[model samples]
Target: MQTAAALRHAQRILVITGAGLSADSGLPTYRGVGGLYNGTTVDGLPIEMALSGPMLRRDPALCWKYIAELGKACLGAQPNAAHYAIAQLQRIKPDCWVLTQNVDGYHRAAGSPPERLIEIHGQLSPLFCQSCGAVDPQLSEHLQRPLPPLCKKCQGILRPPVVLFQEMLPERAMETLHEEMAKGFDAVLTIGTTASFPYIHEPVLRARVAGGFTAEINPQRTDHSAAMDVFLGCRALEVMELLISHI
Candidate 1:
């Protein structure tokens, strides 16, 4: 296995991370055993319905509940080594563009700037009013004690800025991702999340479609793991630290 060095040294790198990246940080993602109600009581409300655009339009309180849960869960969470590795890689390769499907703000907290990071799923930092269309941003401190951020103007319901189910990925961001893949990036790294699985796996799929080498960092054997030229199976943080040392 050629260490992540070669990939990290690429002229143009496009690194896409998914939910798995945050899993090590004590965040609960689907396919994990731990979560609200031990991931069991969510029968009536699948993730999509609870976080989709239409649902937000129908009931803002649901979005509030979702964000509230996330806020609560994030209280004890900290950025793991994998996230720092991404930042380190970014510093090594300034031209690289990093994209992530996670809504959690760990990457940002880990020092990845907004300019270099593309959060495809949106974030929970801001709250928007579905009625008056008012928007406000909340730093981590605000979330500790309160309901989800509310619209100051109309007091209308407020929801987090995530790509809910039935919502399309931000068009501008997707275009940028496609352009990089089409231009034939030197290396494409998929990290920690199901970006190696069915969802958020487009970049890996693109690499395969273009005959480009692929990299995967995940603990499980995702469907496309076999296709990757390099597979680092473990916590993303550990894999990243190893890869960074080599780089």
Candidate 2:
């Protein structure tokens, strides 16, 4: 495949991913069928509001209800072929780095090195106490506890470190992304995302401006579709499975 040809020739590649990357593992996207944003909660608030930082602070119980539900859904899900493919690619190409919008932590679970993987959205694996800054990596255990689980260190409310609607992306992740972009890349590969965030598309745009290859794999057309050198219209897992064979 031409996409594979591009990837094989590239030394330093930037792989950007989004929610669709984990859909095959039974995780839902943010704005699609059965997605978290598709419906309202028991209190009639939109999922966005229910999951926002303001709501978490205003009504921890109400917020935790949805958070616990989401955690439950993600608890048993495993990394799928697409995730493994990315990890394998990174293994073969040591210069590959992944910038993912997923908070599920499947990339790390799939053996993608933490040093090369940037979770643009904070992950669900680490729950932090907003009051004391204590962290609990056992998110599943806390999900099974009372609503708005408390911190073991200071008995304060605990929350997943995920970036909420009202919050900005993690500063460190952003800084690292800028650093990576400044260093330039040989190619840009985007998978499963609509490229709604400007930062998500920035690297690809930059690489394209620098005369580097740019490719996208998505089931549906996205804002970046017009600019991609290769647009594989298929599920991420299916596309990655094929791409891995060529790599």
Candidate 3:
């Protein structure tokens, strides 16, 4: 209720989301690509190593094996009510922005404006050639054919724009985030993430430091929960619609 009131009154809002939010859509919520794996892959490599940028360069087939699985999982699921609720909230609040770690692109699928949505981790579709920089639109088709999809233009290996392990976050997304953070927010509501990383928690701290409201929604208390003005211990799917309705 407090978070809803703060969001309703606040003109500038930042809604931070993570993997847990998309899990409501039946997507797995583990490390790397919603993480269909836990300890190691069939190749006997750690999931992180198998999904890393270096691995992609060294053995694209191995890397893409996992990538394809994640891609299939994402393509199989639809955005749930919470995603739609956030999209609706964005429509209601012109200044509302979504900063998400998810690469599933569910926010975009749920009708959140691309300009207002920041996918810090990048996305899974529109695979591009690392060699010729050619855009490949046949991700689903390629998935059905090969281990490492190749570019039609140059026969180069195609990969998603997503930020793999050991890869840097997208520069443009980071720039946009910093620009908005400089402008500051009146309310910051973090959903579904543990706020374990500095980037994840920085916005919340910024809002609080600027004398604004900050809250979090998660089924369990997280590293940043104690810092929030109000912590809603519930799934985003369970409360996001209620929160948006109040707005």
Candidate 4:
């Protein structure tokens, strides 16, 4: 049973999620049991190199392959019980906020109100023209070739609308998050992520600084996991579902 005493004692709640949350829905990653990479997974030459921004720019083909694989993985993915539970948790508290690192759009698809949720990394819903900066509407279509879409204006290649490895978190999203943390959360739950990146890590720390109940749920111990008051090593969605069922 979830001891939601922490939640019960607070009126403000913030939920943060990372890739681990999506992994539970069968999205592939190189970590944990039965993950995609056997030993060392790389994007083009290797998983690490492939994900590097320099590599992405140098070899668009490699980036395309990596992104397309992700697209394929997302094709059959649907919101799991955990995603729904997060939504339910939002409704349980009137002042609830969800900050997600995932670009999968799962949180939005799961019925999380746009006003209450922020995707710091951008959305997986659309591909954008890098040259002209135009974003295409989200639609599922088969890629006949292994290339990113192009800008209709300049014919320059398009890229996933998501923030890339070299990119910084959107300034607007970051500012809003800082302000939200300043407002004082009742409890803060970081699900399936290690706050490795500066932008993603600070808000969770902010919650802790404010004496907000801090927690995390992931399959492995992470840098941020040790700092949490309640750290549960399990699939993010599974833990979320359990928490939602009780509260």
Candidate 5:
């Protein structure tokens, strides 16, 4: 209720989300690509290395072993109520935009407008070839068959558009974020994230400095929580529906 009150008057709003937002849908709250594994994986390598871009290039099979796990988890789960609530907010507020770190594509599935949604960490579907630049839509089918799915046309390794460990963020997504940042937001709401990355925290800081309302919705307190105008200490699934109703 406090978060809604703070944001109710906002015209331009930014809803920044992370893995925690999707965790309610039964997905692991991965810190980047490694949180599912504590320190090292069963393969005796750190989960970061196991899921890194370099590792994918070095041993596609080994890298894809973990990639396939992520794929299966995403495919098995559906978007939760919080996701739909955020989508609804976007519809009601034409200026509302979402910037998410999760690769599950649940926001898109939940009906967030693609033009307004920025998947900062990239997404997990429609695998593409690394070599010949071919696109493959059979992600679920390939996951069932092999470790590293290959391109049908070039026999190249097929991978999702997701940002792997040790990979740069997508340029276009970053550009869109900065562009919007320059225009400024009337309010910024962070949900289910620790605000660990610069990009994640920068928007919140910018909005605050610009005298904009800032709030966070998370089950636990994060480093950014103390500074929020309203910190709803609860899961997005629990509070988002109510927040949307207020908006």
Candidate 6:
């Protein structure tokens, strides 16, 4: 409730979210316990390597196997309270924008406007052809297809637009984030992320530099913990629920 005072006065806000935000929704972090990569693949490669662009290009079956599994994991996983809280904040403050590292698309599911929500890591739905760039939005349909689904347009292999470990971040998404950063914000709120990427923490650092309030909600301390104006050492869902009431 103490952080509500900062949000009440904030005109423009930026929220950065990560995998931890969706963990409560039954999705695994892919690195921690019960994660997709707690153990190596049958081929003896890390889950990160097995899901890279090169692997997708070379051995599409292997990559698609994990991709399909990820899709199944995301299926039926509803957005949690934290996601809805962010969405509610966006409605209360149209200037509030979410920059999420998650590819799960939960923010959108929670009613956040597509225009205000930036999926920095791309979403799992809308499979696209690697050859012709054709997009298939029916994830369920594609999931029912073969391991390495083919594009309807050119019969090329279809793949999700998610940013693989080896692939560069989507240019448009990064450019848009930088554009938002240039405009500046009144506050920065980070939820369930370690702030591992420079871009993830840059907004918070910039907010601090500009004298804006900055807060982080995580169960454990993160790299940005020392710099946060308010560090709520709690689960994002619980903290967000409390903060939303004050807003």
Backbone clashes, each candidate: 5, 0, 0, 5, 0, 0
Better of 2 and 4 by TM-score: 2
lDDT of each: 0.71, 0.86, 0.90, 0.73, 0.89, 0.86
Cα RMSD, each candidate: 3.0, 1.8, 1.5, 3.0, 1.6, 1.7
- Deviating ranges (above 4 Å) for candidate 5: 31-38
By TM-score, how accurate is candidate 1?
0.85
Candidates 3 and 5, the one with greater lDDT: 3
Better of 1 and 6 by TM-score: 6
How far in Å is the alpha carbon of 102 misplaced in model 1? 0.4
For model 1, the superposed segments whose C-alpha errors exceed 4 Å read 30-43, 139-149, 195-202, 205-211
Please write out the lDDT profile of model 6 over residues 1-247, one tens digit for every residue.
5579999999899999998899989887645322443377666788888888899989999888888877877876889999999999999998999999888889999999999888888888888888999888878777887889898889999988898768898999999899999999999999999758988778988999999999998999998999999999988987787788888
**Candidate 6 lDDT (Cα, whole model)?**
0.86
Lowest-scoring 10 consecutive residues by lDDT in candidate 4? 29-38
Candidate achieving higher lDDT, 2 or 6: 6
The worst-scoring run of ten residues by lDDT in candidate 6 lies at 29-38
Over 1-247, each residue of candidate 3 has an lDDT whose tens digit, in order, gives 7788888899999999998899889887545442334676667788888889999999999999888888998999999999999999999999999999998999999999999999999999999999899998888898999679988888988999999999999999999999999999999989999759878788889999999999988999999999999999999999989889999
Deviation (Å) of 24 in candidate 2: 0.9
Ranking 3 against 6 by TM-score, winner: 3
Writing each residue's lDDT as its tens digit, candidate 4 over 1-247 gives: 4336777666888888888888889876423312236544453155555554576678776666666666667766877778888888888887889999887788888888888898998876677776788876543562455466566678877677676566667788888888887787778888888658776577668778877788888888998877788888888755676677667
Compared with the true structure, model 6 gives a TM-score of 0.95
Model 5, C-alpha of 143: deviation from truth (Å):
0.6
The weakest ten consecutive residues by lDDT in model 2 span: 29-38
Work out candidate 4's RMSD over C-alphas. Answer: 3.0
Q: What CA RMSD would candidate 5 show? A: 1.6
